[model samples]
Every structure is written in C-alpha cells, then in structure tokens.
Target chain A: MTISTTPVPEPVVADRPPEPVRRPARHARLREWWLGAALVLPALALAVAFKLVPLGRGVATSLESSSGFDGTSFAGADNYVRMFDDPVVRSSFRNALLVVATLPVWVVLPLVLAVLIHQQAPGWKFFRAVYFIPYTVAPIVVGIMFRQILAPDGPINALLRRVGLEPLAIEWLNGRYSALFSLVAVALWSFFGLGVMTYLAGLATIPGETLEAAYLDGAGFWRRLFHVVVPMLRPTVAYWSVLCASGVLIWLFPLIYALTQGGPGDATMLPEYLVFLTTFQFLDRGYGSAIGIALFVFVAVLSIFSVRHMFTEGTRKPR
Target chain B: MNRRTAARLGRYLLTFALVVVAVAAVYPLLFTVVSSLKTQAGFAEDPLGLPAGITLDNYLEAFRRMDMPRLLLNSLITTVGGLVLSVLAALLVAYAVTKLRFRGGKLVFLLIIVTLTIPSQAIIYPLYQTVLDLGMSGEYQGLILAYAAFGLPLGTYQLAGYFQQVPDELIEAARVDGAGHFTILFRLLAPIATPALAALAIFNFVWMWNDLLLPLVIMGGSDSKTLMVGVSLLSGQYDVSVPLVSAGLIVALLPVLVIYLVFQRQLVSGALAGSGK
Candidate 1:
C-alpha cells in the first residue's frame, strides 16, 4: 500500500466513493469487524445491563416470592396461579383483550384524516397543528384534564343535556363500563395524531403522479384511499400498529392511575396498571412481575412485526 | 344541483367536520388555560363559561408552593443528559451498523430493535434494582442512563437512517487518513448529522421531561423528582381546587408549549421521518 501514490486530494469525489475492487484483504476485513463491535459496544453494554438483565431478572423474580425485595421461598407458579384465580386480575386481562379489539378504530381514523390533510383539505394546516398538540402533552396532564371533563356532570354530559338528549348522558367515570370506554376514547384522541403524522410521511413518499393517474381514471378520493393510498400506506400502518399495541399494554398506566384508577369493577384495568398496583400499592412484587412478564410478551410479539421492514436499507432514499 | 357543485359542497362539509375534531382535540388544554385564570368561586359558578374574574394568584401559588426551581433543574439535567448519552452512543453505533457492516451487523441492529419489545414495566423492577445496586438511584446519572437505555433503540434507529446518507468515499477517506471510528464519528459524522441530532435531542428531551413513572418510582418522592412527577404529586394535593390544579397543569406544560411553538415544523418532520418508508 503506497500512501503517497494514491491521489492525495480530490475536491469533489473526496466525499464520493471510488469504485470498489472485487476483493479486500483478510486483515482489512478483520479490522472492520473489530471496529464495528467497538462502535456498537457502548449501546450494547447499556442494553444488556439495564434492559436485558432486568428482563431476565424480572422472569426470575416472578417465580420467587418476595417481601419488599428481600426474598427466600421459591414459589413456583404460585403467582401465576393466584393471578388467574383472582377475579380482578382476570378481568384486567379481559379488559386487555377488549382494548386490543379496538385497534381498527385507532389505526383507521388517523389514516383517513392524514390522507385528507395530504389532499389539502380546507384549514388542514390548522387541523394538523391542533391535532398534534395532544401527542406532546404529558399523559398525566391529559388524564387530569379529562377527569374533570368526563365527570358525571362534566361538559360532555352537560352538552348532551342541553341538546335535549338527557338519556345519552351516562356516568362518564363512575359507571360500570363508562370509564373503560372513556379510557379508550382518551387514548384514541391522544394517539391518532401519531398515526396521522406517520401516514402523512408515508403519503409524501408516494408520487403525486400516482394519485393524478388514479384521478384520471375517474377514481374519487374513497376509491383512491382503498386502491392506491392504502397499499402504499400499509407499511406505515403496520409500524404504527405495533408501536401502538405496545403502547396500549404499558402507556395507559399514568392515564389509568390519574383518571379511572382501573375502577368501576376493573373495567379499565390494563396489565401495566395491574402490575403497578400489585408491586407498589399492594407490595406483591411476585404477582406484579408475573403480570409484567405477560405484558412484555404481548409487546414483544407485536414489535416483531414492525421491526422487520422498519430498518431495511430499502426504506432509505438518497438525498 | 350540478355534480361539480355537489362535490365541492361535500368537500367543504368534510373540512368543517375536521375543524370540529381539531377543536375537540385542543379544547381540554384550552379549557385548562382559561380555567386557570379564574377564581375558584368563578370556575365553580360557571364551569363551562369564561372566567368572571381573573387573578395571577393561582399561578403565583403554583410557583411558590412547589419546589419548581429544584424540580426544573432536575428535569433539565436528566433530559439533557439522556439526550446527549443516547445520541452520542446511538450515533457512534449507528455509523458502524450503517457503514461498517462488521461481523453481526444484522444481529446488532436486530438486538437493538429487540430492546424495543421489552416492556419498560417488565424491566422496571430489575432496572430499578440495577440502579439501586450502583447506588446511583435518584441521581441525574442514574435516571439519565435509564432514560438513555429506554430511548436507545428509537434514537439509534432514526439516527442510523440519517447515518446511511454518509457517502462511502468520506468514510473510506477518513479511514485512509488514519482516523479511527471515534474520530470519524465525532469529528466527521457528528457535524454532518446535526439536523437528525437536533431532532433526536428535542424529541428525547421532551419525552424524558414528560415521563412520570421513572421519577416517581426511582426518585421515590425525594427532592430529586423531575418536574413532571412533581406536578403530578402536587396536583394531587390541590385536589378539588380546579384553579390550582389547572394552574399547575399550565406550569408543567409551559416549556413544551414554547418548544412546540418555535420548532413545530422540525418536530413534526422529525416525528414523521421514520414512517416515510
């Protein structure tokens, strides 16, 4: 390797790659592997220490009974047995199933709104700005505000009464299933902006000529949404769904804690909240770990789907 | 009616409906702002209407009653520290993952993504235990590392996307020029990835600032709680006093509101950047 012979300075192609040779030396290839491992070591070390170990430890702790972090007895499957038998915990799992069922409403509304905004609907700028505000606001703050708004005689119900529909004004918080639905609605409201933003990004990648061509074929907005826009947007939707499913499992803790307390008969009790309650409130670390493991599995499963395509080189476009 | 006229009318109606939904989205926050200005009596008198009276007392109380300065400082340290840690680490490794194609490049990237699937709740206990074992619990370094660990996947993922744009010639040039990975990353790549770095910083900072659980549990109702967790605890004490709670909510929200106002476009673009694929 003669250092002096190779061109010392090329102004333009200095930043551009010279054509690759068919082969590289073995030592050079070995150096690349060491460099790569060294580069990734910091992030990898942190993940292993903070995330991976705890994940394994959490599973370990779930199998062992603990009284305030000091533990002795190996309670093999007792926590799981207790969790399944306990009616409140059972209902919490059921509530999770119900929440998961609402994934369509969560995904579709934002996709539709994003497409409308992409089409340049009236006041779309204002709509986009307004819609995104909630995403930035802390969930706890939103929870506190919604607690008031959804109080038995709160503004929503107040409006219902004023509109001559008194029968429709059910108890928003304290009723049997009202708080559950209220939780779902608030989650929906806060998160759809995320979907809208993502889909809008997806929409940008799409050539306008595609939509224009569809329009030329006598396709209206509805037809285009299904045939043209949707197929292009599926990847984004998949990513958002996985992100959101994990969110539903874990992110609802603050809102549930602040707004509903998983009350009115465990209707709104998500597994995360159940874990929180078990660990902190009741000092049942064993049971909480069990619930947390279940929630972790659920999230891990959903995340697998999204991460597959999300990081591929094909996703990148040259500037 | 003619077909064209009807289509335009329908479009207008859809726009009108969208506007209504937007109003619904922002109304609670707007209501909190308006309600914060009222006397407790005034708010109770007309919960749905504009305040009949105005005073800055609640805001004053909101500031004075809580340890806002300490909490704010704690928040700044944790969030900014987390942002730097996550970005620097992510940027270093992202360069490798994107450009190095070293042994197990795919495996490394996949491992990072797998971290995303681990529910923070599941790991919260052991993460908490790890911090305690180090005795760094409640300190900025502890919380910052925890936050960085939590945020690494998304940070690395997004930064790597931007990292892919670095031309091979530049990386090769640096290598040929005797620059190691750190030199290549910090002096060379870091400056070029400023836009992505800024986005990651703002995004991570806001997230750490807004998070309540970590501060609440790890900080453990001590002097070290972040501003968000402080406000959460503070509002509980205010209880039924809508004026005070609203005032507190407004206080907690102010910084993010300012950031949003100034960097709205960047934030939106940064958030949506990943979904483009």
Candidate 2:
C-alpha cells in the first residue's frame, strides 16, 4: 500500500526473460494463483494462529482479573495498578534499570575486542571462533555450568582461597545483592560474541580503500577509529544497543530459571521473570500479561531510535 | 620507544588480554568435561585440578537419571521437525513474495519486519492459552508448530534475502514453461540456494534445540521433555551431585558444539550475509 502498489516501472525490475506463452489459458493462471495461495497458507496460518492471535490478546487478557477461588471478571487497569504497588515488581523493574545502566560493558566490551580482531591481532582467528562458541552454547547450559563454578565453595572461591584472598570470595550466586551482578557478569560472558559478530559484520562493509586513504593521510589508529570506523558502525551499534537494552526482558528468562531462580529475595527477578513466575508459579495470568505488556512497551519505546537507524541503514547511501 | 616497538608491545599486550578472555570463555565447558570424568570425592577434594582419576561413572549416572536417549529423541524431533517446517514454510512464503504474483506481499513482508521488534514474551501467555485450547499441550505437532511459527519471521526474512538473489529471469523462464511453482521452486531455485537453505537449517535447528522456554511450557511433565528441560530438571532433582550435574550439562552441550564446530564457516557466512556485511 505504501509505494509498491504504484507499479510504476521500478529501475530494479528485471526484463521479461520469457516469451509470453500465449496459450490463452485462463484456467492455468487461476491454478497458478491457487498454487500461490496454497503455498503461502500454511506459514500464514501458523503465524496468525500463534503469533498474531497471542499478541492481540495479550493486552485484553492483561485487563481481566481472576483468582483460584473466584472466577474471571473485567477489571480495567487493576493488573497494572497492582504491578505498580507490589514491592517485588518494583524491585524487578529497578533491577532491570540496573542491568540497563551496565550497557557500556554489554556494548563496548565486544566492540573493542572485535576491533582488535578486525585489526588482525595475534591469534585473532582462533579468538574469534572461541568467542563465538559461547554464543552457540545454550544459555541454560551456561547457567548450570556457572552455578556450580560460582557456588559458595566452588572453583572461584577455591581459587581465591588458593591465592590467600579468601575474604574476597563472598557468597556469589546466593547473595541477594550480589546475585544480580554475578548473573549479569555471566550473561555478558555468554553473549559478547554476538556483539562481536554483529560489529565485525558491520566492519566488513567499510571499504579497504577508505582505511588506506586515512592511513596515507597519517591518521593514527585512534583517529581513524573515531573518524572512520565508529561513524560507519553507527547503525550496527544502534542495532546491538537496542538488542542489549531490550535483552533484559527476554534473553535472561532461561538463565534466571536455571541458575538464580530469582533467589534470596528477588534481587535478580527481572520483569520477564515476573511474567513467568506470576503466570506459571502464582497462576496470576492477568498480572503476568500486564507485566509482559509493560515490559513490551518499555522495550518498544526504547528501541524506536535504533529501529529508525536500522531502517535508514538499509536505505543508506554509501559515502 | 619508537612507534614500531610500541605497536609490537601493544599487540603482545592485546594478545595476552585476548588469551585471558578466550580462556574464560572456554574454561567452563572444559571444566564441565573434565569434572564429568572425575570421582565425586576427587571433585570435592580438588574441584579445579585435573582429575585424580577418570571414570565414566558420572556420565553413566547422568544418562540414566536424566533419561538421555528419550530427552534427545524428543529434542531431535522438535528440532528436526521444527526446522523442516520452518524451512519449507519460509521457502514457500519467500518464493511467493519474491517471485509469484501475489497481492499484499509487500504488506506481509513489512508486517514481519515490524513483528521482529515485538518480543515473543508479550504474546506467550495467550499463545499458551491457544495451544491448551487446541489440546496440544505436550504434543510434538503443537511444539513443532510453535517453533516453526516463532522461527518463521527470521527464517522467512533470511530466505527472502536469498530468494531475491536468484535472477528473476530464471524464475520467469520456468514460469513461462508452464512448470508449476513447486517445480520451479524446488527444481530450479532450491539447488542454487542450497547454502542459504543449509544455513537456515542449521540456524533453525540450533535455535529449536536450545530453546528452553517453549519446551518448558508446552512439553512440561508429559513424558516428553527435551534435553534442556531434562538437564534443568536433573539439577533441580539431584542438587547434591556436582559431577552428575556437570555430566548432564555436557551431554546437553555436545550436539550443539558439534554442529557449531562442523558448520562454523557456514554460520559465520550466513551471519555476514544476513547482517549486511
């Protein structure tokens, strides 16, 4: 409907490579149309049934109230009001903020490493593969592995003891305040490869001649980086930052379920965790849907800037 | 020091840091493998050391306790079936949008791009409700459909990218020959886009395999647990045995690691292609 409907001859449109088979067979054309519809129907049906239906219902379900004893009824904004008033939900949102505040490490750590790899640092090839391996491993597997390693008497603590830094080895995953930090650290460890890959993918697009030109102009490494690479990677950075920003509500679900389980007084209880716990554990479908919607809104609003940048990235003219 | 020497020093320093990070990345999985071979008492005594003795006891115990074969079969069905469904569905839709004369194709693609931004968490409860209503709570058909649906947007988006690369003339020639769209797609275009299909195959397979949430909800407590759910359940049920837990994690990680190791180049190439690299 936007502009595709015009059918004004597109510059990119291919010429008719086939001589028109003028059989005058309207039935064949009808069959072709039917075939297209048939081919598209399965995917469309599943997409509609699972994705579109759930998304449309999420908000409506959020507005309804029900209890185990009492049946369901219409309750406008009651779920939202209850979410705001609850301490655990408040703490979940606050912790989500804390995670968001640590975006620098999430964004920059992989970027710096990728730059080095892109620069062909020694062992960069092996390191690139090594880093991406973490991304391949399931988050649940990572959580289970880290859970034991971060256990009170696990290798981390034992290593600290070996170095005579026993006092530094506090309860890692079990500590209420420390749990969220440790969880973030683990997540960063698990996911930085994705950022590296994304940045490296962006880095691939900048022509070598541009860098050569900069070098001939005596642009130093940092100078070339700031002036050339970062600007070019702006879209890539935006894409990843949005991903990391909104990642709080989605990617951490399995990790929290496996390792922390929102333990020791809800320090690591993310909004997504709240959704799962409320919906499944407490059986509060209405509140869970409401929290899910709120989180969705937060992520949607936060990513608007990045999504714009990404769309522009597709349309951007190479300078 | 001269700039040359400084650069060399910087390279060495960066190499050291890179090694440290790489080791941190690989160590946990390495530790899991090593620990899986250790005695419980040995692990208790020296958790970080090379094992005092090697044994398959933990693996055996974990396999028995976690029901490895059944979990893997269940996971394999979901992954293979899901990937097959996703690829076929995506291939068909991408072909239609890119090649076939279809109204609303542009809007459909746009809807998918917009839908990409809407996280699945927002819709999961209602999705569960729909699934339950259909009486497909723990059925493979339901799980496959869910995985296929969730993986579709990305799958179709990627497939469209590859589909567009096939010169329109080739498809039009086939169309003019009175060849069916199915024949044109599978016979003419698919052979050429094998790399894309394979990449999407591995990509969707790994995703469906590693996915914990969908399986967690749909396949819960129905004698049909996937590997991830099984491993998680193992840890919860057998909290005391660290070695056994490590074994369970290793078993869960093995196939994914193998796929990654074998198909690394394809994965990287696919990522680059998909990301506009």
Candidate 3:
C-alpha cells in the first residue's frame, strides 16, 4: 500500500542496541507472521472463492461448448471464432467503440464543471451538492425515471410541444441513434457528479497563487482553465478517463435493463448486457463466457496505464 | 465592450450556465417525486404540470404489487450482512499488511487491488454456476457473499491507506502492554479508524442496496429479490403506470437519499478514496 514515490530517511542500524532480545524476537517474528496470515485468511478466501476462481473458471468455460442432454465437451476456440462471425457480437463491440468515442464528453464536461465550481461560481456550494444528487440515485432508478420522462408522451416531449417544437419531440429512447445517445447521456447525468468531485479534489492540490498569477497577467477564465488547471489535472483526468472508459462497458447493464433493454432494435446493446443475454437468456453459456473474457481483457488492457498513474498519484507526497 | 463590463458579463453568463446545469441535475428526481404523488389520470392528463390532486394510491399500489416490505427486509439483510463482513475482512487484512508487515503482505495487497479492474460482469456465469453448485442460489448468503467479495478490494485498499498512517509506535506501545493483535486492533485501532470504517460501510451499503444485476440473476426466481430488482421488474411490466413505477423507485431510493443527506461528506470522501488514491 505504501508505494512511496519519494525517498525516506533510512534507520541507522548502528544506533540500535542489538541482540538483547534476539531469541525472543525470532519467536515474536514468527508469531507475527502467523497472525498476519490468519488475519488475511478471510479476505483471501472470499477473493479466491468468488473472484479469482470464478475468473479462471470463466476462461475455462469459454473454451467449452454445451448442449442440452449432450452434456459438455471441449470446443477449443469455437466460441471465439463464432463470436467473431456473429453479427450481434460485432455490433455490440461496435456500439462499445462508439461509446468509447464519446469519452471526451465524459472526461471534459465534468472537468469544465469542476473548474467552474472550483472558481467559486455564484451559488457554487449549492450547485456542487445538488449536482451529486443524481449520482446518489441508483442507476436503475435513474433509468426508470428517465424512461418515464423520455417516453413518447412524456414530460420532455410535452414541453417540446408546448414550446412549439413538436417535431423535435420524437421518442428519445426509441430511435436507433437517439436511444444510444440517450443511454450515454443518462449515464453521464447520473455519474458526472463523481467526475466533478474528482476534478475538484485535483483542483485543491493546485496552488491558488498560480491561478491568481494567471489572472493578474490578463488570462480570462478559459485561458487560466486551459493553461493552468488542465495541465495540473492530467493525472486526475487520466484516472477519470480510465474509470469511464471501462465503466461504460461494464456499468451500463442496470441502466440498459431498466431503460431501453437493448432498445428498439439492439441500438443500446453494449457488451455487458450482451453477455447477460447470451448466457442467461439465450442459454449459450460458453459463448457468453467468451464475450465476457473478451470484455475483461479489453478492460484490463485499458486499466494498465491508469493503474500506474493511480499508484504514483496516490502515493505522491502532497506539497 | 470595455474590460470591466466584459468581466462582469462573463461571470453572469457562467453563473447562468451553472444554474441551468444544476437544474438539469435535480429536475429528474424532482419530477419522479412529483409524479409519484400524482394519480395516473392526472399524470396522463398533464405529464409535466403540477398534479390536480395528491394521492397515495400509487404508493400503496406499488407497495402491494412489489411486496415492498419483503423487498425492504431482503435488501436490509444483504446490505448489512455484506457491509459488516467486507469491512471486518478488510480491516483485518489492512491491519496485517500495514502494521504486521508479514511476508507476502505486499503481494496479497496487490492481488486484492488487481481484482478492482475485473468487472463482475466478466465472471457472471461462472460465479452463478458456483453459487448454484453450492446450493446457495435463491438464498441471502449467496448475494451477501458476492457483495462482500466485490467490496473487499476497495475496502482493503482504503483501510490500508488509513492504517499505514498509524505510527508504528502506537502498535509497539500496545504490544508492550502484552496486548494481542485482536485486542490492539479492535480496542485501539478500530476506534481510531472509525471514520474510514464508517465511510466504507456507507459505500458498501449504498452499493449493495442499489445493485440490480447480482440480485436479478442470483435470486430473481426466489421470493427474496432485492428492492432494486423488484423495482426493475415493476418497470418492465407494460401495464404498470408511470406514477406507480415512480412510486416503486421512490421506495427503493428512500434509504440512499436518507444516507446521502445525513452522511454526504463521508459518501463523497469514500467515493474519492475509490478514485485511485
């Protein structure tokens, strides 16, 4: 846990009185090790039993095919090959790519909002607290809430009609592109609060003098935000990006379930939900495991860069 | 177009935009609460306007249909059980790795942290199979254990950071009194670490209460569905009124809202703790 980035003063070995308790020290050290192992046992057991073992079994499951009454047999890479050729699988990955493409909005919108709040915009405290309210509501609740609001005869369209914009009042979660867009937008709405809080935490680390100096030199809000704030927040931005990039794939299942349910024609079918359908609904356990492994590998690779940045950022001594 | 006026104008514009965003953030929940109070006919008549008359019928109907009391009990049991188990395990592991400094402590910590990157969806089927094999499906322990396992990584990571800050001198002094690890940890370290434990508990509670997928897949067929799964099922029913569904959502969301209102600071800090550092 102590992945310290800075050097520490080493203990002076010669200064310590040696060996008076050597015989007892050996016994104590052994006891300490034993105690430590015992303490770690529960967490280790839970992790191995639920996470690690299932993960390994998931990989093995992906390689085997099963049929009713025929039992199971090793199918090698058959699922993976079929996955490549399956149009639904291809489209799910395609949708995932499109979601990833929208990562800039996921990253930048909150950064901008956080900057504005950090600058102490009027009513900033209230805005800061209120913005996080949506985040507290469960994704399923948020999805259900939006489902009502986005329905064809929902409040949003009602307002649109009232404003004489009837044509723009199409079903938000029904159209192909619009459904995907709505899904992403709702996810953002529910999550941007955390992103804002993250950037604000990063903003706290930047010295106020830097911002003051930039303003004194005639830099406006945008100038200071870009030149000073964004540069200082690179690690925080990276952390949030990694979270969102992986999160969009894995975390959208509940929302998708309650909102569009892969929509008006697989328009909102992300890989996570697809994995569920293929396994639980379609009973293609092997193929589902294959998709699941692919998703895991994709996420693991995306996480590597951030994991490094996170450790360094986490362990860095604050000035 | 002078400098002073331009600065004033920019500030006003920025404030105006922030106001709009803030409203967008809160309006949906407000809409839900408002709709939940309206009759179905009132909602159908004027979806956006204030209701003509308030009615608790939607709430009552939703309560009956979703079996709110049963869902509430199931959610409470799983969330509390999960929170206690995860926090206790994490505390022990954190204390051992940071304070005891045993062999392989670093590796153990690393393994737990690595699991953070593995999404639960990736191993859903195998995990489901494991639960079924153990004959734990449709039981509270199945979902409780799953929640505890997933909660361990972040909980341990955060607690380890807190435990690392406790000076070795504290432990040394406790040991000088001939106190065992359990005594020192529970009586001394636990009190000092209350804030971190509270934060972890709140985070896990909210997560377990709100989670739908695990409950949906694990206990979906049983009478033990969590509130979230029940609400989700309610939403899926085509004949269910929007107001009724909103009521169900409100019932499910009430606890989270209460926790957020009361422990907003701990919640925010806990979330930030999970944000890498």
Off by over 4 Å in 2: A1-33, A212-223, A302-319, B177-179
Better-scoring candidate (DockQ), 1 or 2: 1
* lDDT of every model, 2 decimals: 0.79, 0.80, 0.82
Predicted candidate 2 versus true structure: per-residue lDDT over A1-319, tens digit per residue: 0111222222233454456446547776666567677778888887888877887788888999964446789999999999889999999999999989999889888988888788788878898889988888888888888998898888888889989998989999878778999999999988998899888888776776775565445566668767877787888887788889988668898889888898878989998888888888888888889998898788778766655543343323233
Q: What is the lDDT of residue A28 in candidate 2?
A: 61
How does candidate 3 fare on TM-score? 0.92
The DockQ ranking, best first, is 1, 2, 3
Ranking by TM-score: 1, 3, 2
- For each candidate, the DockQ is 0.51, 0.47, 0.46
| Model 3 per-residue lDDT tens digits across residues A86-205 | 988998999999999999999989998988887788888788888877877889998889988888888788889989999999989989899999999999999998799878777766
Candidate achieving higher DockQ, 1 or 3? 1
Give candidate 2's iRMS in Å, 1 decimal.
7.1
Q: Write the per-residue lDDT of candidate 1 for residues B92-175, one digit (tens) a residue.
A: 778888887587776787788679888677667767888888898877788988888888988888777776776767777666
Top model number, TM-score: 1
Docking class of 1: medium
- CAPRI-wise, candidate 3 is acceptable
* Deviation from native of the Cα of residue A17 in model 1, angstroms: 5.6
